[model samples]
Structures are given as structure tokens and as C-alpha cells.
Target: MDKIKISNLEVFCNHGVFKEENVLGQKFLVSAILYLDTREAGLTDNLEKSIHYGEICKYIENFMKKHTFKLIETAAEKISMNLLLNWDNLEQIDLEIKKPWAPIGIPIENVAVEISRKWHTAYIACGSNIGDKKKHLDDSIYALNQRETCRITKVSDFILTQPYGDVVQDDFLNGCLELKTILNPKELLTCLHEIENAEHRERIVKWGPRTLDLDIIFYDDLILADDDLIIPHIEMHKRDFVLKPLAQIIPYKRNPVNHKMVIEMLYDLQK
Candidate 1:
């Protein structure tokens, strides 16, 4: 959407590889583009409805002076995360960290790192078939809500469903959750795995039975594939347990691979 740009603002901070660089400090120029919806603030002329650029500059200045890091990369990472966490209305950040003074002998203009970071919308499928199935599912949602990088936006009511794979086990309580997350796909997967292990989940017979099963149904519009994880879950549209809940919240979300919306998939499954 809309953006507020903060051009090259100079600040002196101690961030370098050399020992003296940390002691003496150097000049750094930072530029940031803050993304947000300005319609509310614009219409009302309300300061509270918008992010204050003046205050943000002051925050940046203070943070630069307070922390001493060996590399600008580290500083940029922390700053971006902090901005996203602190500014509720901000949707994304485009940041550039420029270092004018360099040890290299060549006369170069500047060395800098530019990066883009944003909160991604993710949908997760959670199920449990073993002991305390509902409890396990609820606990996993609680755990995800506690993380700073993850915010649980919505959760579907648990539904009883038969076990997907061939195994002599009890029916599962399945549900879906929508989240706004700053964590990357891999990082989010790791967090899910951690929650599963905490609930004593097991993977003996390939989705046969478990205390908790968490799967990534969707992450933004991303189409990702790896040995350990896959995005836009490969078979989610084909499973009623998955579509029933997912369609509740994101009925219009389209599958990047198949070019079909959740509503279309749900209708197709029922026929």
C-alpha cells in the first residue's frame, strides 16, 4: 500500500570489524521506507492514526548510540525487527545501512546493505489423534500465540475427522489457524516442530498417529518445496478436514500452483 519515506539520515555509531572501529566509532547513513495504510490518518487528520516519522528517527538515533555491534548486518537485522514489532500499523520495511568510511584502499563511494522485510500471512493446519487430542491442539495454538514473531489471528472450531493414513487409531480433532508472522517459512516450521516435540508427538508410520500434527497449509503466495517442508501443503485442497476449516477464514485465497481459490476447491471436493 502506502509508504512514508525517510531519506539518508546521518548518524555516528560504533559498528565495524576492527578493534579501533568499535572504540572510535564512524558515520553511518540510514534510509528507511515505512509501509502502512494511510487512509484512516489521512481522512481524519489524526496524529494517532499514523506512524510519526520524527519519533521513528529519534528511536533510530538512540538505538544506534546504545548498541555496539561488529557488523552493520547485525544492527540492520535488529533494527528492522524492532521497528516491525513496535509499530503495529507498519506493514513492511525497506532499509538501507550505509557505511561511508572503509578500510579498503580503493576510493569507493559507499558500502551498504539494502533489504526488505515484512509480516507474512500464514495458515496452519493442526490436528491430534492420540491422547488428549483437543488439549494437544489447543496447547499448540497457545504456544504459537506466545511467540513474539507470531500472532494468531483466527482459529477454527475443532472438528472430528477420521485418521488420514491406514493405522488402527482414534479419530482426530482437526482445526486451522491464521497467523500474521515475521518468521520466515523455515523458521516457522522449526517453531512448529518444537511445539510438536513438547507435546510428545511421534512420526512412526508416516502420519499414522501422533499427539499433535502441525502442517503449513499456506505462507503468503509462496510456492516452496524442500526435502523437509513444502508450502501451500501439497494435498490440502483434497482433504475435507483441511478445506472445511481453511475455507471458513480464507474462502478466496488462491493456490499459487493450481490457480484455484479455496472456495472453488471446497466446492470441487464436495461434488
Candidate 2:
């Protein structure tokens, strides 16, 4: 909730659409606000507990000088993402990239791009129905933990469950993991897919047999429906395997659409 602000820091970099802009270079001004919890630092009077503004400025300068982009939009996005990845305490960032002396014929003050990015909390249901199920789940957790943008905060005990769909294969070892992530929904989905593929998970049939199954059961309070992904997992409320393990860790987590807690859903499903 607290912020550390850096205002109008100037840098010289090559980032522009025109040919001459890249050849000759130009001046860029950046403004940033990093959101974080500084309470511990304030209470303990420890500099390590807080983000170092000087270090951040140096990082931004280096990043801008090192990379050449055609647009300020790209520069802003890359810088924001880099800052978020480098700083663990940073919860959100408001970044602005200003380009002065534009090639436009008009005498404008400056052209700038401003944007905000933040981390989201998401819950994933993980399962494996074939070939070292426990190993599959453990490896998935280890993979998530290794990511800089994501942290595995908690995991539920695995439960043995019958196959939910018509596929007659093996019972699944299902569980859930709660993650704190800086990755966007789509990025997180991509990471999950990559992890699955690394485990050699074969999707021969829907809900058939898998080496690892990672589903985004909840993403903040978001309600999303897309061709490749669905948020709050469409059938999570009805599946005891999901609700049971979810209840073990996040009993109070609510279904975005139903507005019912996981504990309530699990209880109701029993009858």
C-alpha cells in the first residue's frame, strides 16, 4: 500500500520509430512509483527490508541503455516487467516513459507512455493419474517454486480420487497449490502448459490419463472464459477432489460466480 516514487529521471537512449532517432539517439525521461509494504522496514529501521531507490534507478538506466526498441510503449512494458522480476518486495508499479524532441512537426512538450502492473494470487489444482503420481505433483510444485515470477505459498495433501470423466484408466492423485505470482493469466497458463509438457503429459483424451494436470482453479476474483482457458474452473464446485483439497488450505476461498466458500461447497456436495 505504501509507495516509493522516482520522478522524472533522465536518460539518453536509442528508442524511436524513425531511422534518424536510432542513429543519433535521443533523451528519455522516466517516472516510476513502486508499491510495497514498508512496515517491516519502518518498524525495524532496516534498509534491507525496503527497496533501494538508487539501485532501481541504476537498473532502469542500464536496461534502457542496453536495449533498443522502436516504441516507448515497448520500453515501458519491458522496464516494468524487469523491475517487477528483480524486486521481490515490489507489489505493483506505475511507470511512465517520456520521449522529448519528437520528430512530429508540431511543437509538443513530450510524448509519454504510462502503465501499471501488479501481481495476482491464483490457485491451481494439480493431479496425476498415471506413472509416479506423487513425483509428478512434487515436480510441478518444484517447478512453480523455481520461477522468479511465481511462488508456491501453500499446497494441500494429495487425495486419491476416481476418474471424474468417462475415461476408464487410473484413479488420480489430486491436490491444490496456492501461488503468489507476478505472471498474467495467459502467462501463467503458458507456464503451466510448459511444466506439463516437461513432465511428458499426454492429452490423448479429455480427462483421460495424465502424467500431470494443472488447472487454474481461481485467479484473484476474476471471471474469465476463453477458447483455451476458463477461470474458477467450470466444474470445480461440483468436484469433491477439487473442493476437498482446496478446503484443506483455503476453506474461505469463494467461487466467484456462486459467492460460496470452498468449505460451504464441500459440505453441500456431501448431500
Q: What is the TM-score of each predicted model, taking all chains together?
A: 0.98, 0.93
- Number of the predicted model whose TM-score against the real structure is largest: 1
Model 2, residue pairs in steric clash: none
How many backbone clashes does every candidate have? 0, 0
- In the range 1-271, model 1's lDDT, one tens digit per residue, is 9999998889998888999889999999999999999999999999889999998899888999899998888888888999999999999999899998976779988899888889999999999988888899989999999999999999988999988866888898999999999999999999999999999987779868899999999999999999988898999978989998898888999999999999899999999
lDDT of each: 0.92, 0.93
Candidate 2 lDDT over residue span 74-189, tens digit each: 99999898888878899899999998888899999999999998888999999998899999999999998999889888999999999998878999999998999978899999
Model 2 regions lying over 4 Å from their true place: none
